[model samples]
Target: MSYKDGYKWRQKSKQGFKTKREAKEYGHVIVKELDKTALLTKDTELKDLTFKEFADMFLEIKKGHVTHNTLTMYRHAVDAYSSINNIKLSNIKPLHIQNVVNKMVSSPTTINSYYKVVSRIFYIAINPYKIISDNPCTGVRLPRVERKNMIHTISDEDLNKFAKYMREKYPQAYYFLQIARYTGMRLSEVYGLTWNDIDLKNRKISVNKQLQYVKGVITFEKTKTANSVRILPIPPILEKILIEYQTHELEFEYDLVLNPYKKNGVKCQINTYLKQFGENLSAHNLRHTYATKLLANGLDVKTVSALLGDTPAMVMKTYLHYSDEMKAAASNAVANIFS
Candidate 1:
């Protein structure tokens, strides 16, 4: 028998009933008991929903709290998963998830990110929505990822060569490189710099924001963090360069000090100008050059860390190879005493 409350019910005993009304009442009591039991049991609750519906709900709720860059990554992962296997929520199994993961040919880090997003969705469904009994991704193992260092530090000799090349080929870009080397600022931060941010009297530049091209439009946003917003002292040579550059900018009536050429008052594409010099280096290489030079000059890790807006540990980890050479030189200098 069935009840109007959308539950199936049945009589336990085969004893004959006195009337149809008595049978209907017995069916209602059985259905109420079953409904209570369903709430208590895990298996019954998990069988109610589809995986696709749960994922959609989770993403919709998460969209408001996350940044646009984070949302883009989440959307990419979810869309990729949905496109490959159109599995329903109730029918999804551990093996199905494993299969979908195996088919992905991306790097270990990327695959792990995909798994993380999916795992979070399942976690929300289980606790908050009460749609699933448990998270399916509980014990799934991810691939090990070895961190690869890809930064190339510009050497002093090479830096001089690059400067000369820039001077000869692109005079304006040469000054941009000079500021980047002295300030240890990121590419976006350098591009976003304005004349007002520079304190000629104090010989410092206040880094507060970054300029980026988003969706083919120029947008200015806050620096990555409170620590990232800093004031860096300008080297004397760079200060002279800036003074001359500022005068030039005023003569041309350009808003930005770095790249005077602009489209609708926005900074021009620096990378496009950089390419004319050569393929040996880029604008970002200037930052690496700054950090490496600091390490080479026997500067303490903490000081370099602060200047570069990184933690001391990160500075040690990334520049330790250079430090090792310094250690060897010091050891050699004291070898006569041991000998």
Candidate 2:
């Protein structure tokens, strides 16, 4: 069991106790040990810290462990819970925390995200300081939410219409869209593409890194996952397009294929251009559409998983759920085998 504000700690016995009574007795012994060791008792042995004070210290400690983006998000989450920030660290009850959570005007997911930061702050207050015991976020009820993907599958008719419209009205965005549709690359992965990574001879791209634009600085960061660092085989149509696009003479930043415009600049431009073809169309939507079509056409989930730099479970849950053909196939497979 984890102690409140105590490093989110877990204490478990390796071997199973022979009887329920034995287990209960052992647990009682551990509870006594925790009472002596843990700083959660109402006793005034140490100074009571404010939630805000402990949160600041925890965030500073977390800087080296998480990405700058993640750290920034956590900071924002903490700021969102400012109503209870001044509460005594040990005095925070579940009801007090729940009331603060209920006050958030954001979605349930966003509220939960903020609550995690608050919960962690409480956790750290228990350890090294012994200020509190038991997390206040436990048993908090969150509203049900349907997840909306930034990436949406475009209908085949819309896809064709967009292709024609983009080519005629926005050639630069069209090329970017084509590359994304053909490769199923994430926005950052597409931006990070270079001539060196594009193997024309092998017809595969070495997706080892991605473009990270942080604080006006451009850097090559590791791929989102180890699976994201695999080779992406280029189709003949895409290879032809890339060959022609490479010939465009433009000053390169970090040898990026889409030159002149940097990652953020190009991303904004591309999204702006997509508005004419489809309302709220994004570069990410093209990738989702690509994965949807692949799953619809009988492509195995495992193969699709690797192609999209996602796990099989994720591929099935996110992309395959949209494919009626896949669902039909699953039904037919069970019927045919059993009957």
Candidate 3:
């Protein structure tokens, strides 16, 4: 049986009664009892766990599951949450969480990230751990900031100029940029690419893994998600560029495509070159350009999502600027059919 406590719908009991009247009476009793007593009773042993202790346990549980970068972020959040160090898990309230968040001088995005880590810790404590009855992080209001699309894709004319300049001046940067622009692969995925993963004859580039920083050392790791491990088509222009690049670069370390450059500080090097073209572009902007071009040219969302190694929902959410235009075009096409 379930009951409504003003706006909140709460489950009263899982047991079934023989009659509707009995169920109604049982639910009423439960609601009255709930109003008189606490909604959730905490265990004596677990209720006394300090916020810092629970956070440490949470980090320990997350060690192997998350990437090195993600773990570092978690640690940073843990450090920021030291103000509530001695407070018991069940004793903490929304005001406590909100106070900690209000004290942070970071940007909205950074604060949000930290809040997420804290929120996850509280959530786990409520569920499987059962250390806390309620999540204190739930009702805390975050700073509101205007969301803007950060992708600064190159124009067709500018792309041509950028490509020519990179090819002539920085062959290595050109190779990296070409792979990223054509394939819509992430920077880490590109860093993980080797000669063996490239099927040049079949015109397909396999994305099996990515380069990740683990304990200050760069190493090969599984893709970000299961969908990330996919094969992308190599366009004719990209194929030509890769072929030339492969011929010139032989006997490299790990038989990798970009042996000398590595993963660290490569973005800075590319972005420095990007500034010369008079566009505020990063390595990821190339990927955005590729996906946007595909959607603008009339590719379906599912196909584009598959090609980009992301879910259709994520593709729609991220590329809504182009997707919205596509939606408008689709509406016109439907109207034209009736006409």
Candidate number achieving the greatest lDDT relative to the actual structure: 3
Candidate 1 or 2, higher lDDT?
2
**Distance from true location, Cα of 215 in model 1, Å:** 4.0
How do these models rank on TM-score, best leading? Answer: 3, 2, 1
Clashing pairs in 1: 50-89, 51-89
**For model 1, how does the per-residue alpha-carbon lDDT over 1-339 read when each residue is reduced to its tens digit?**
432323554434434779989888887777666564454325543555566666676778867665455677887778657743355554566676777678888989998998899878777765665555556677666788876454576666766776787678766667767788789898777767888889999998989877655665666667755577788888898888888776664532324566534322221334444455545456666777788888788887888888888888887787777778779877997896688
- Indicate the TM-score of model 2: 0.74
Question: Would you list the clashing residue pairs of candidate 2?
Answer: 5-122, 5-123
Candidate 2, which segments miss by more than 4 Å at Cα?
Answer: 1-49, 61-68, 120-133, 147-151, 164-171, 260-262, 272-280, 323-325, 333-339
Q: For each candidate, what is the lDDT?
A: 0.69, 0.76, 0.82
Q: Estimate TM-scores for all models.
A: 0.64, 0.74, 0.83
Pairwise lDDT winner, candidates 1 and 3: 3
Query: What would the per-residue lDDT of candidate 3 be over residues 127-208, giving only the tens digit for each residue?
Result: 7776665789998999976666644677778777777887787666777888998999998899889999999999999999
Question: Residue 29 lDDT in model 1?
Answer: 78
Candidate 3 clashes: the total is 0
Q: Which portions of model 3 miss their true places by more than 4 Å?
A: 1-45, 213-216, 260-262, 276-280
